[model samples]
Target chain A: MARKGRAGAALAIAAIGSFFAGTVSTILVAVFAPPLTAIALQFGSAEYFSLMIVGLISSIALAHGSVVKALGMVVLGLLLGLVGTDIYTGTPRFNLGILELSDGLNFVALAVGVFGIAEILRNLENEHDRDVTIKKVSNLLPTRQDWKEMTAPILRGTAIGSALGILPGGGAILASFASYTVEKRISNTPGEFGKGAVAGVAGPESANNAGAQTSFIPMLTLGIPANPVMALMIGAMIVQGIVPGPNVATEQPALFWGIIASMWIGNLMLILLNLPLIGLWVKLLTIPYYMLFPAIIAFCSIGVYSVNSNVFDLYAVAFFGLIGYGLAKLRCEPAPLLLGFVLGPLLEEHLRRAMIMSRGDPMTFLNRPISLVLLLLAAAVLVVVLLPSIRKKRDEVFVEE
Target chain B: MKSLSFSSRDLICGALFIFIGLFFAIQAYGLELGTALRMGPGYFPLVLAGILILLGIIVIIQGTQIEHEPMGPIAWRGLLFILPAPILFGLTVRGLGFVPSLFLTGMVAAFASTRMRPGTALWLVGGLTLFSVIVFSYALGLPFRRFGPWLGQ
Candidate 1:
């Protein structure tokens, strides 16, 4: 197997880019409360629900592996979320008194174990036998055609992500997925995906970054979280006992506005950081699989253990890793499962809450305009998928590894 | 020559999904599920189980209709080691501590390599161990205590 000599350079660039992107987006979300709040003050619950609906659908788009496998992964994610604890009660659901699982599986542990450790296992199995050919050196610059193809998708993604981010749940991640799906569906060339379509990278990347920036709108204005990351931010706020609400912008303008200004600054920072570092990031691809696999395992173990200082998560990681490996062997992509796991609980909780609010009227789903719209969209997708003429296209879309 | 196919395997997988969905439905029934409006604990799982059952039926039907392209027999050696590695990690990780457990795990995993030589493998393992320690402990600042903390400390 030929190693990409420049992988290290490429990886370094990506790391720098991602760091800047992540940090700037975070700061912007944190700082931009007052002005953005004023701008978004008119929105209400329906808008919030629509945003969440969009996020949920879009998150499903993020799985880049086999469609069936991704679906299975999503289901598995939902199952994990449901395994323990009734939200309304103080009682445990599936902890079995292990205590670590009382809170349900930690996201970090699940992510690290399945993605990190299982990846190592797969690499190890293929190490020596696998041909390690790296592509011939090519220019990193995007061509004019590539730029033309990417611009519309990126703008659309930004709009979709920003709008969704203003809602109470479904943050940057969901926006990323939503943007990806939109771009894919609308693109004239739908088949040129999974092979690093510039649109695939550019659009979702833009959406996520923009979504990350906009998610602070609800958190700062109305005191609601758009996604888990924003939830973490809310935790940070609560530690200070600043009960987040509509008045947050009025009460703490600098804290709100500073965070917003920082986002713009942060995006610039990321672009600067990542642009020159791509070469370094690329160089990381050169590391021998032997060395890389072990590192992945070590990272997974460490990441999982740090979540709770418990050794049990380590065991869980290994277990999931095995499951991940098995899924891989079956040619199933694990992305969907991961997404399902993340969204399953939310979907369940929301659906139940809606039912509870409606007091047994099943028509509530159809009667509510927002709910009806989302359901209709979902139906449209299903109908398109079920058509015989689209079967080959569906397979191609879902089975991309 | 006459050919065999994965029709049986597909059929089995489809059946397994259906069974799993039904089991979930049964479990949902045991929960206090309540009225449609006042959904108890089991509403979501019940819905999911129903959906999964539908999907399972589809899979079974599709499997029956598809033609399987023949690939040769499985590589038993690779299969045996690779399949068990994750399980072994799960079984051992908690009690063993990170470094020692990982060393053993990596060593075992290396056996899946088709052309691995013993000496080369040993060197790779050492490099892996060191790199892992430095990157995870030093770079990421993860609290990884070396095994026993006695030999060098």
Candidate 2:
């Protein structure tokens, strides 16, 4: 669209589609959250443990590359998550006499290292000058034909996004991909998709916005992060001394409602601001990657240091950056690892608590109906991913994107 | 029938997992392992380590069966320069203080790219340090010695 001098039209379509999707999905979240919270309130430790298992297993299914590699990453992440003073026993487990590590490795430092620093390093490997030629955006409004093309896709995308975003692990990314596939498959002008068909951009943009909005459902209701962004939000909540579980709705009604209200306002703000700021965004793309990365490293160091003013965390960032880069080179995805890290302590706590409650009978997982169903679901996911026919299909799907 | 060939990528990946798993397993063994109903700190990690090791073995076996892509070019220059930036910051932040330490960190990171000139790096780092001091120190009111004791501030 930009190459064809229709940048403004494309931008308008995306913004309008996203706004509509965001509004609808926010309403869905508001409607679904209370009931989900009520259901969550009834859950025991066994159910929670099974739920996390389902989450972890599904993460492996969704991760690109070898399933075994992804599983290994998850296990490695779980082990790394355990490196600190044992919560129950008060005996330090993996600190190796580093007093700074008694509180466990800082989550922010690890996240910045793995996702941020590693990505920077990867980009540096292929150093070529980026030549950006942005067309002057003139058509600020979409044509009537554009509206006719986009309406159905926007609605379908909203539905898909709202449903998938409630699932554990990274759903927004999946929702967008699914929406794009659906749009291309259903469109009469399928050949136009890669060439920027109206439905192509409209569907995935709407889907991703809706998915991002509704992903809050799992985070707010169960205190289980739906993605890494949600995990970061949970971290922020902990820092602010707010426990992020089912009780949050009742005890901190203001905060819960405030977050929901902010979603609507934020969507509105984006629509209002984005069109005018489009040129600025284009200009930002003109900045050389080389110049940008040094600033990123500096800011990352300062940000990590400012968290606790502990220099040890900064060292961890460097260490984990190398680890993350190494893992990337080995074709292991980091998403599963991060999710495992977040859920490790919680999963272990629930497992021990559930076992103690059941008097050491492992059958307790099978006996409890909710836990049994969740475990079965996890098993089903694992089995489906492992099936040779399904594995080939999965690879094809990823390759198509 | 084709002869079996192992993928070096998977072999290394599997070995790394196994090595880390064994490390954790040995450490967990040193801790007291209680019964299932009452798991000690070591029990859960020990189980996870075992699973990791098993998965590693599975990975190695799978490597022998499938043809794989060669591991591509590594960012050696990026690794040498980029990885040390944060460690350098950590080592000198308190001693050199935020201004000097951050400047040095940014300067080191800038050289990671072959495209960066020395003059450009100095300018970029200088500007970054100035901006950071203003935002992080003055506006945010984070309590850090802008100039640390080592600077006689």
Best model number under lDDT? 2
Off by over 4 Å in 2: A2-8, A129-140, B1-3
Clashing pairs in 2: none
Q: State the lDDT of candidate 1 residue by residue for A148-199, as single tens digits.
A: 7666666676677666666444567667767778878987778865554666
Q: What TM-score would each prediction reach against the true structure?
A: 0.69, 0.96
Which candidate's TM-score is highest? 2
Deviation in Å, model 1, residue A362 alpha carbon: 2.2
Docking tier of model 1: it is acceptable
Q: Report the lDDT tens digits of candidate 2 across residue range A19-52.
A: 9999999999888898899999999999999988
Against the true structure, what is model 2's DockQ? 0.84
Fnat per candidate: 0.24, 0.86
